[model samples]
Target: MTLAHEMAFASPQITAYAVEATEYPDLARRYRVTGVPKTVVNEHIEILGGLPEDAFIEQALG
Candidate 1:
């Protein structure tokens, strides 16, 4: 979540969601999210795993 916090600090326009571990089960099952730190952008781009800031930004914005 800290990464997300940092991102939010870096870009005011960046949005972040903090899905709880309990709620994650449902979303994970529904979206086939099978990993920690998975990031979904606009509900279309589902990034499967953790990534560095620049790489994550590129994927999210590119």
Candidate 2:
């Protein structure tokens, strides 16, 4: 969540959304989200679970 917030702060090009899986079943299904704290970057990059900051950033931005 912090990374999402930081991305929002660091770049105007990025848009961050937080959604409840139960409420947005279609979205959850689309992303194959089976757990909490999943991050879908640019609608393609799927980073599952909590990660160390550096590792998360690498997967997210790389």
Best by lDDT: 2
lDDT for model 1: 0.75
Reference-based TM-score of each model: 0.71, 0.86
How much is the lDDT of residue 57 in candidate 1?
76
- In model 2, which regions exceed 4 Å deviation? none
The models' CA-based lDDT, in order, is: 0.75, 0.88
CA lDDT of 11 in candidate 1? 94
Predict model 2's lDDT versus the native.
0.88
lDDT of 2 by residue, 1-62 (tens): 87888877889887888888999999999999999899999888989899998898889987
Count backbone overlaps in model 1.
0
Candidate 1 lDDT by residue in tens digits, 1-62: 67767777789898888777457688877766767777777888877677887887788776
Lowest summed lDDT across 10 adjacent residues in model 1 is found at 17-26
